[model samples]
Target chain A: MIERTATIASTVGLHARPASIFAEAAGAIDAEVTIARAGDPVDEAVDADSMLALMSLGVEHGEVVVLRTGDDTAGEALDALVTILETNHDA
Target chain B: MHSFVGVGVFRGRVIGPVRHMPPALAEPPVGERLEGSTAPETAAAALKSAGATVKELLQERASRAEGAGKEVLEATALMATDPMLIKAAIKLVNTGTSAERAIWEAGEAVADTLKGLGGYMAERSHDVLDVRSRIVAVLRGVPAPEIPDFAEPFILVAEDLAPADTATLDPSKVIALVTAGGGPQSHTAIIARNLGLPAVVAAAGVTGIADGTQVFVDGATGVVSTDPGAAEHAAVAEWQEKASLLSVFDGSGRLADGTLIPLLANVGGAKDAQEAAAANAQGVGLLRTEFCFLGNSTEPGHADQVAAYKGVFDAFPGKKVVVRTLDAGADKPLPFLTDATEPNPALGVRGYRTDLTTPGVLARQLAAIADAAASSSAEVWVMAPMVSTAAEAADFAALCTAAGLRVPGVMVEVPSAALTARHILDHVEFASLGTNDLTQYAMAADRQLGPLAALNDPWQPAVLALVQATVEGAVSQVKHSASLETTSPKPVGVCGEAAADPALAVVLAGLGVSTLSMTQRALPAVAAVLRTVTLPQARALADRAVAAASAAEARELVRAGLPALAELGL
Candidate 1:
């Protein structure tokens, strides 16, 4: 599995607009992807493509969150999603 | 006709059949097992099918949605297609639970988890409930909970409405709104005014009125009548026709004697500015500056504040725009700005007083307004709220001058400021009376207290006396002072609910208020009434109103003088 950890950088965190954008990006990829707070258990991680679950995580700015993908070549997808998480959408 | 009373949200009259929103759906039975051995497998398939139906519906809605609605609907659609939610429901079904019960249980679990996270996530908890209801409705073979389709415009009757319900409502389809419970500042009233729909809120027993029963709703006087007679119906039709004609009058607000009153609108932010301008408001009378700071954890940056101020200023090119500085406190407490847990927040440090202690907060705002004004053709005038003393007024005017603001004014909301307005106006260029607060202070009533609402009448003799004192003070200043502008008596405008009342508006104008600013929906009625009365007749109405012993008496006295208000059923 390909996995990465990134701190949320958006002023409003991954909520409303940012969550939708992240979920839409994850949905476009051809691999299973999940996200959760860094220390959460594997089962607690939610489908990254589900905007509702991503928003329900309540990942605030400066909090470390993790993303995982089943495909080995999904490194590019993970990087793109991480960039969005680390950008301040409010600005 | 049997009648009930509420607080009128906006001035207009309409006759339509009552339409009650359907009550909330009953809870689906929990933990019920299916009939046979194939029940578990059958339940899982049904659950999947129901979820898909919900998914398809939400996806369709999302496709047509725009802005925030689009984001919310798309997120909801995602929820319907969520594999984890489906799996959870299936697990429940594996234990012989019914499909509807399993889906309900699964939806609640996720909703509770999100709510447990608190803050913004907790807000989305309601969205989970919305999704659950849609899926359950599909499983139960019933129509999803939504506004019923109707061929004709109808008066909407409801206990209360969620923000989403209001977002989906077509204003044209809603002839008027009547709610059993809500206040002037409630979402229903605010939305009704924003959409230019007449509304009456807090009407007791309004929910008891049967759907499809013909009724007359007078949003001006807050009267809801059932089985209106022919004459009452004709009166409503006449009022509606006159209102339409009044709305089309593009000419500026003036008295019968050709004395210009300059009707303006009280706007919260730029979003409302365009609406006010379209309503034919001469300019913005009160541009509240709190919108820029409300949601921010910290102070908004200079550029952000500048952009917000510029949006409003640009909307009123070549017109007088009076902007009030950040006036948050009490009912609108800001954590970054003040303590949210004050005992008596109304009397606590607020408005310009908070700006004094915070120092740079007001300075940054003034700088932003100055920056916005530099590029706009609008005649921008800046004002401070809740200023009680002359020294504070002088300090604020000095700050405005430092920031390059041409016009500096103070809101005479406090009685002390109104009584000592001559001294306050000596330093400030103008004074605008926020009659809501002034009435509250003058009558010793809390503005937000429902029971004390009666005491917070602007027509109260004491309140009018205070307004009279302020106007007379400003007149005295303009007449005596050599440094001040002598063209007009340092323009004093009424920018509050009082200005919305046609009779009280005339009294305010008669009391020497040079301008009247109110919610845009109320401008036409006030303007229409103003066109019927000469300046002298207005002054006489003011005199009769002020000479009365009580608010009710004062209102009656003034109402007697303005026979034109009878046509509008004021």
Candidate 2:
């Protein structure tokens, strides 16, 4: 398990286009990934492929979310996903 | 058949064989069903197969158009993958139906879905229409139909036009369009105006006319004459020539006696700001800040807000940009404003009212506007919406002034504000009548309810009475303050649907509206109307409009008062 904190750079946070883009990128990696807000239980596992599920979490800007990935390319996947989340996509 | 009329949106005459858009494309070939297969199972399999074929066809088209028509193809691909349509098909199929039947049923179900989603669905519908058209063409095993050629320019009649149908139409060859369905703000109406084609929408029986029939569309009168006599044809030709002449003047707006009125554009975002500048709008009259709040989950920070304001300010260079702070509430619900509960949202705690309930939100927004204005040469005037009382106006003005923002104004939208305009003007630096809301409030009618639409008419005497009061208050303020050396006259402007109406523009200008702020597309036409009448003539038109019993009568009275101006072709 690896832990990292990143601010939501997308203007609209985890919703609609941004969430869809992040979910698509997360699904491409061969890893069992989970994301949660700080202090929230890890049991609330969200499939990174579902935009609706990601948006249901209501993750907002500057809120820290924990990302745990268990796979050979977990580090690469986590880095790429975090980078995408921290940048505006709708533009 | 009973006849109904609508304002013509495009111009051209088409006489040709009628070609109705073919129904849903034939379903993809399905594998033979096993004997005694359950209806549900067979339906599911067939639907799955149909979906796969649609997906495959879209992918192939996209790949083929990758370099030359990538944007168009990509939009079609989105339609092909629309979850709503796919879900509707699945639901229908699961209830037991052939794939072809299910697809057709789904298409019918989603046809009205676009109407409920506003701008987002309007855009999506364009793509869906494209996909449907392509599928129909494929099913027919024919190339996409060529633009229909007419021996002479004739009217193009249709039941209703999807945006895609209008997209491929050639404006030059199309003289006029008449439709049985569509409203003033419908996609077809907007597209017709953009193409400079005369059109009349919601004219019943327009599509029922056989092909090669002679039709005369009078856009201004919203009348369609089928198989018109020679006299009518000659009159329409003369009107068309006048309309062509009116299209020439577009630079600055001036009244008949040469009184200059600044014609500005109302923009909602950065893209709109750019378009306004490109279209020669003197400046942005109303830059709505609600969009930034409505689309995001959290309040935009000072830096974020400032950046957005700066973008618009920079775009106009040296021109004035009036930015209205977040008017979100009831009518436009922001996701982050969870506590903004109202039984009647339109008349609820919104505009400046929200500022009192949500601490720091308005302050932060004001700070951002101030900071942005400080960096730009363009003047930034900040305003608030939904203000009904003098106290609210004073409070907002004081807050903005304390934050070092210049020109804090209040939108005179509520009837109370217009009725007591004198009190409100004493506190704010300027005022802009949001006529749409004021009309709704004055007439005690819900503007959105189609049934009460007649009562909610902006031209109603009651509505214009409130507008007159607001203007009188502004005039009184100017009179009282004109003698004071420290303060300049506070100019009153209008930013609403009424401001864009060419006929109403004359009335508003006559009623002492110093500025007219409207959509970019409407500026040129409104400016032309302004140039045709002097200030006194405009005032007389407004007076007559206020005395008229109905919108139609008011319009006619104003038209009769300005014969030369009418010839300018509004």
Candidate 3:
């Protein structure tokens, strides 16, 4: 598996619209993606496609989080998800 | 009809069946485990199907929704179909837990986990609970515990409503709001004001009233009548007819004899200005400039203040825009402007006094207002709040002159300012009575404290006497006034919550207030009531008010003279 980390850019953190948008994007990708707080162990990661799991991560704005994908060709998917996390939806 | 009296925050009357927000569902009992007739697989299938059904229902609603509420429904729909939910339920069912118990336990586990995460996640716990309740209700063939899906409008009676509860409500469906407990500034009242629903708060025993009980709610009088007698039915019909007219403002503010009193709006920012413009406010009477300095750690730059003011100015081109300078300190303390704490902020360094410690702040804002005025078509008139002495008014007027703004004024919130209005108006152009502060200061009551709300009323004899003094003083200086473009000494106007009252508006007009600036919703009603009485009658009403022994007595006295008020249920 491969991974990437990016800071959440939404003013209210990865909440409401930002979280929903991120989760929907992760679900559309053909990989089994997982996310966790940057300092937490990879074993503690949750499904990136699940809104509940994404929210339960408590990823606040400007806080860094880790994104990982098990699929080989999905290395690009993690990068794109990182882009969503970095873009400020509120702005 | 039995009448329950409370504080009315909005205007109008409506009769509708009250809808109680559903009580929370009972916890599903820890019934027997999946055995015999109810197989574990069958239990698991039931939970999954319930989830699918709920998800489909929410998905359909979400598809038609918009904005933050739409996002809420969409997120909830995703939670309903969450695979983790069913997997956990199936695991519990396999462990011999009953289907109902498994679903409840699985939902609780997820909700508890979300709550534990806190912050944004904690709030999402509600979404889980919402979905959980929906799934359970679907399985049990019962309605979900939430706001109803009634076909017609209603009077939403509740003990109180949370922000979440109100978000799902369709404004059109709620004819009025009756709450058992809340103040004028409560969340329920704010929502009612935003929805333009006539509302009564602090209403006792309203929640006990059953659903589908037809009730008469007169928002102006704060009377919620359960019995719809023949006379009450006629009153409702009259209210509907007059209220329909009150909803459409002609943009002209005058008495029956055509004495003009420019009705204006009190706005905080550009958004409010846009709404006021749409509501056809004569112009902005009080442009509160606190939005900038309140949020910033330091004073906002001249350019930023200019840009902010320009948005409001753009909305009311070629109209009178009375802009009050930044009213910092007091209840609204800015770190850069005033001390962080005070023994008595109500009496401490506030309003125009904030400029004493930080001299350049007011100067910077005045220059910015002039800068913005230069670029826009609005007739920008600047005023300073809390001017206690004639020297302060003169000082403020000089500052306005230096900034190149033509019209300068001082708010008569301070009793001293109202008492010395003639001396102040000699230097300044006009005086606008901020009756909220005027009443609070005159009565020595903290306006924020709920218990002291009675003394803070504008109808207080002492408060009316002060308003009378301010107007008389301004009138005495009418012709000799340096700012006199017209001979009309209606120069002393009102721009407070008191000015919004229809009964009080007539009194202010009678007392010779030139303009009445209030919330836009009050404009049509005030105009409607003002049209009922000629200038001489309004003057007679003001006389009755001033002669009354107490505030309640004063209100009743003035309300009696204007039978049109009772006719329109003002």
Best by TM-score: 1
How many clashes (backbone N, Cα, C below 3 Å) per candidate? 0, 19, 2
In model 1, the clashing pairs are none
What TM value does model 2 have?
A: 0.70
Native-referenced TM-scores of chain A, all candidate models: 0.95, 0.87, 0.94
Clashing pairs in 3: A13-A61, B490-B514
Query: Candidate 2 lDDT, tens digit per residue, B424-506?
Result: 88888889989878877887876545345456567777878788888888777767764566454467899887787778889
Tens-place lDDT digits, model 3, residues B179-282: 87765645676577666788998788888887899999878878899867887788788878877877867899988999888899988899999999999999
* Predictions' DockQ, in order: 0.44, 0.15, 0.39
> Lowest summed-lDDT stretch of 10 residues in model 2 chain B?
B13-22
lDDT of 3 at A29: 88
Q: Which CAPRI tier for candidate 2?
A: incorrect
Give the alpha carbon lDDT tens digit for every residue of B473-538 in model 1: 998877778865465678788997789888899999899999999888778888889999999999
